[model samples]
Target chain A: MSTPKMNATGEKSPQTRAPLPSQVVKEDEPILVAAAKAGDISAFETLVSRYERKIFRLAQNITQNREDAEDVMQEAFLKAYEHLSGFQGNSRFYTWLVRIAVNQALMKLRKRRPNQVSIDEDVNTGNDLIPREIEDWGPSPEERYKQSELAGILNSTIADLDPPFRIVFQLRDIEELSTEETAEALGLSVPAVKSRLLRARLKLRQKLDRYFRRSENQ
Target chain B: MNCKTLVVELEDYLDEELDSELRTSIEVHLAKCKNCKLIVDTTKKTIQIFCNSEPAPLSEDTRHRLHDALVKKLGRPRA
Candidate 1:
């Protein structure tokens, strides 16, 4: 709650000047959170700027609408600011923020389609047959050069997944959140997150294998 | 572990969620089974490619609008 020290010129002291939000690293988050909780608006704004892109993309992935995602991002940040006092610091600030962003995005989706089923209810049972014929995608020096194209294909493939699987994959693999964090954010059980992630990864692997095999044939 | 069991558990194996005993069993099976080994290796590669891929960046306009909106809501910063 201590105020940042100011120099004779009325600018923040060099030691107290916060790093640019983009330059803020993980270890600095708790300090930022404490500052924000102490009514430092700039501190909270730094948190917003740090996670804005990631939250926007998560929203976009969930809502599948650019405008809706933008709206969700704004709303999520506002909600975070309002609830900043309640953040217990038990979880990482980003994880808490992600939970809020995810809830906002899902709420937007539900508002658009009131009859949608819960994502967890549609979970795959994890008993799907493994394709016996999956071709080996051994390391190839040339394939490393096609990363951009692979990313595109991977994006489209992820988009093709059912909502439950896609969200799980986006959070776990793409965003690289831990299984527990993803489960909490999605309001799913840990086992459910693991199952959905497995199915999503297997599906993506099958698709990529087919693509590589086709390219090899050509 | 047999191929069917190993196939079913491959994802867990790769995720490191399997207990050490089961993990060792899978490792043993993978060493002797070329097809299972191939599946595991390829699946690992698939995950690597996706994880290494970057998500799309937010546009400049969106970034600016977000910042401006926050600044307005939070009030102007004091020097």
Candidate 2:
């Protein structure tokens, strides 16, 4: 097999992807927000149209339950509507809405009666923390990428991340927000965001390493 | 920063959030510490792979339900 070319740093030459256009379409969310605040429903609808998907995804990521996510999404938008007049435009509308969604989702989690698992047990007994003989998790990152199953496995591994870490990773990773933006959205300090993101990525790597190791051994 | 400090700052370094002075310190350490370099590389690749996964699309029914609820609560504004 012809090996993929390595760059100056001895890493695969990174493929460039087009940047996502900024999500805020209208230069003036404040204007739309102002109209909505005045009970102009059209302006409110415009605001909703701009942010529904992002709000939905944020809720879903936090709740990890489709039904709960739907409820959180609805409640968040409704709350935003009720308090529309209160918005001072101190932050981007999307950022404010994200806070609302995240708050709603967390409240839902708390109300649901958390599962019986102990926090200490969950942390100490986490899959990666348990010591096991290192298995060669496949040929290496390069070789593993060639496998058809790797993608599916990787997807599942991300799902397996703890919710807090997963949200941070999703915001920083999938959303491509800068660390500062993510911290602001999630109500975390940049350092906290950095640590959570790193821990999340490390956990994911360990999980994939386990999968590849098993595959190689078979 | 030494390997120990660099290891702690691995995430900040990878995220490009480290201040230039601190970044310079870490880069100097990375040049000497192969282990720290590997950790950085692996962490970056892991994040890239995780984030690059296809986003899950929102369900149509969920979208409709949200729209309906928002309309009911706020009502459509006058033209």
Candidate 3:
């Protein structure tokens, strides 16, 4: 048998398929969340099966360490289960779960980087929002790379961003949190979330442009 | 709107939060400004790529440990 390959993100090569996750529960999340809150173990397991991969990725992106990421994901789920009764279903369960996970990931990140004072510094880059690269990447440029290569490009670029920008971007873009939700999750004002999101998007675009640019495609 | 202002409002434009008049102004600027247009398009693509990409699968061992830990910690929930 061929040994499993590893990538920059420490994900086992996509080829060494992990045992296919069991049927991802098709039920609406609120229903599952309700059941889990009611002590229905299988319902909670279904939620776990449905979200583990995304939660793991969110943690890995924030902590940038696989083991730390795993711990964060595990701890997040445990806490979510422990606090199930408090969840009022006011927002999406996933979003609420994401809030718990982000808090867990940030705690791990803060412990690892003691000198970094805060992830919500409200940076001001007056008149610095211009795009340096002016080239078009034709439609579906990501289709140009194989999945693993594309994943590598994304992971490495995001890992380079300072934690503040990276965390906002991860929640807003990758996880599809609303601007307000992202703000609430991180304890930042809505404006602060907007500011960081703009910088993060532009910076990520500049980084990804190297490989996806029209010139690079030629 | 000039490029700097356009850039500042880029997220709002992309997210379609701008009222129509402001949105049209940005759109007009995008039509006339190649650089701004590229920035908008590619920034959009960047979001789309990450948004659509599948999360990598968890290793089975990691999956098992997560489940085992939950069960142990939470105490298997009452049936």
Candidate 4:
């Protein structure tokens, strides 16, 4: 990856960047989509080959079960095939397909589990002239890099978060999705996504720092 | 605000989704309060790490089974 170049807001800008290749889909995408819509089996197979892996992974993440994920993926593809004519290309095919997969995965999850977490915590905005202080909850950058591998620390900490927090964490934090996008995907308000994301991050950070501290002593 | 009240609103502050007045207040307090500063810093880093994570891949067996089921359901010839 190229070093990030900052803009006026100090957020990274693309212009001060290396010329990376664009990630536009291959030129054949529209052709294949059209043919698939017309019952061209080969074209449909190509689309399946292209998107199956992504759809499967999304299902797996949501369901967190191999068998359930497999079922959801298969069902999503079949549903897409039947409704291919209705595929208006409003969004990328994969985005639409993933939505179907998410719905199916959540359906299966809801069926097997009757319990949903209660989100009773009121979003408290403090009376301070300035908002409440926000602090870092995780390890220092140096400690993070020096401790057990980042991957291991992340996995254990993520698993330790509350269930709803874990789900939001997985979808937004891990997925690198924007707040609005995550909110739309999960049917939550933007405020709700922000709240869960903060809580999830704080919990994980605490867990990671504690884990590394213990390991360092041992 | 005291630490108790600040802690409760910490979520909105981190997101920068709070109103301007609240945002400034929080920033001011964070600059002075070492404890709260540590929490915010750690929280931001934790999320950055989590969001930057590479997604795990599906196992080969699961992939194979999914493909087979799709082909059977569609009855399409293998490419």
Candidate 5:
């Protein structure tokens, strides 16, 4: 894997990073967690390395700032390693780690946006959830763009969403968290999570329509 | 299921949380409604596209900084 050179002290999130290898032997997370708890520093480092990219992405999507995301990622890993003893293994280590990262990301987001990203929270009345423009994207609409272009489009579209909707979508769809888990992580009700996720999907679909409408010639 | 009802139930239906009877109703409406079908298809694609995309890797300097901080705060990692 060739490294991209840029910045000092440093910060780097490239516009293009190759997709992770499709086939790499992955160790069981529980075993790694057990080893780490037993004072195996290498095992903990392995866990950090395994999840660093995903956690950073989650933070960046939530915070929409590279520098804050980097800080949040570092804090999340440090916090996870600190609290490793209390993890209890009731959930997947990754899930536990994700919860930590989500908390850190949300704090960064709230500090930056100030009352825009709410947990107590903003209410959407569900009155006008119906989408107006419902046009076929044809088959495999996302294939129309190169991966880097598509990534840029995805990040921008998601960034445009309200924080409530964006955070719900990130947890549910991107992070693959369960409804109960998402609600618990964000301190929202299960129904609220579902409704927010629905809005997020619809909002994102509408946003992407212009780019993927089969006639954009993009 | 009219369009409004379909939208109300879309999340549960997509997540397969709805009972089969309601699912059948939504599917029937989707079969007859072109717009609803497109909305559902595109929404599903939106989820897929986001889920499939990979996160960009951290720069070497940042990774090293994180590890260094961890080492200094806790202790050095075994080689």
Candidate 6:
């Protein structure tokens, strides 16, 4: 396998860049942030380019619609730009920016579905535990073949999750954000983030189990 | 640990959030219980697959449009 090349900053070169595992970049974001706060538009643009795709994907996952995601992306960057000075840098720039994007996405969702209940509200009080008979299917030939199809299945299953669970899964599992960061982004407690993440993962596993089992039968 | 007990602690176990003693106990149980082991292993694989999948990039047109709009609002400054 060809070794992945790195840029001068030791980040994966943009040309061959895969989805970033974490939002953190080692480059001098604080300098760019300072410049942007002082009206350096180019500085702000650099930051935008670095994170726009990530922000867009996060929006897409939450909204479950590309168009709304685009709108949210645009609104998020603009909102962040306008509020540059207010950014205290207490958190990573991407984290702060994500908070803005998530809010925009959630706002759009609310408008589109006015009767929609808050994700925190109306969660079933009962245990509603998942069935325990999860199949192993360890290292089968079908597992190798199923890799390609997994993406589609994963997307559909995730989309089927309730907004609260879906958002947590997107941020925590897909984006690989820390539980604390996920909680901060969604304005939930750390325990809440963990609970949602656990449920989301369990649900996805169940879905995958069923999908693989059916595929094997077929 | 029994299956019910294991089920309650499974997420934490997989996430390595449990205390070392609890983790050891769970591991010991997993070694003996094929069903519970399967659940843990599969759940781990499910998370791994999801995380490893490459996220689709934003369309080029969308990228340019977003950049241009931002540039228009916040005029381009010299690097």
Specify the highest-DockQ model's number: 5
Q: Assess candidate 5 and give its TM-score to the true structure.
A: 0.89
Q: How many backbone clashes does candidate 1 have?
A: 0
**Candidate 6 C-alpha lDDT tens digits along A1-218:** 11213344434233212334453364688899999899878888888878887788789888988899999999999999999899998866877888899889988888888687365654542355446655656553235555547667777888888898888888766665567777777778776776777788778778778766544555
Superposed model 3: Cα runs more than 4 Å off: A1-27, B76-79
List per-prediction Cα lDDT, in the order shown: 0.72, 0.64, 0.81, 0.62, 0.80, 0.73
Task: Give the alpha carbon lDDT tens digit for every residue of A1-218 in model 2.
Answer: 11223333222223322223433235667788887788678888888777777677667666667798889988998998888777777656766777777778777765674772221122321223222344443324535454447656765677787776877777666555556666776666666676677778677767776555445656
In Å, residue A29's CA in model 6 sits off its true spot by 3.4
Angstrom error at residue B68, model 3: 1.7
Q: Report backbone clashes per prediction.
A: 0, 2, 0, 19, 0, 0
- Maximum-lDDT candidate: 3
* Cα lDDT of model 3 by residue, B1-79, tens digit: 9898897787677666677899899999989988888888888888777766788899999988897898797688423
| Cα lDDT of model 4 by residue, A8-81, tens digit | 32232222112122212456777888898887888888887776765665666666677887899889988988
Clashes of 2: 2
Worst 10 residues of 6 chain B by lDDT: B70-79
Pick by lDDT: 1 or 6, better one: 6
Q: Rank order by DockQ, top first?
A: 5, 3, 6, 4, 2, 1
Report the C-alpha lDDT of model 5 over A1-218, residue by residue, as the tens digit. Answer: 11222223111122211123421224467899999999888889888888888888899988889899889999998999899999998877877888999899888888888856686486774678777767778878878898889989999999998888888999877776678888889998888888889989888988999999976764
Q: Which of 1 and 4 is ahead in DockQ?
A: 4
DockQ for the candidates, in order: 0.32, 0.33, 0.42, 0.36, 0.44, 0.41
Winner on lDDT (4 vs 5): 5
lDDT, ranked from best to worst:
3, 5, 6, 1, 2, 4
Candidate 5 - CAPRI tier? Answer: acceptable
lDDT of 5 by residue, B26-47 (tens): 9999999988988888887787
Second chain of candidate 1: TM-score?
Answer: 0.74
Local lDDT at A188 for model 6: 80
Q: What clash pairs does model 5 have? A: none
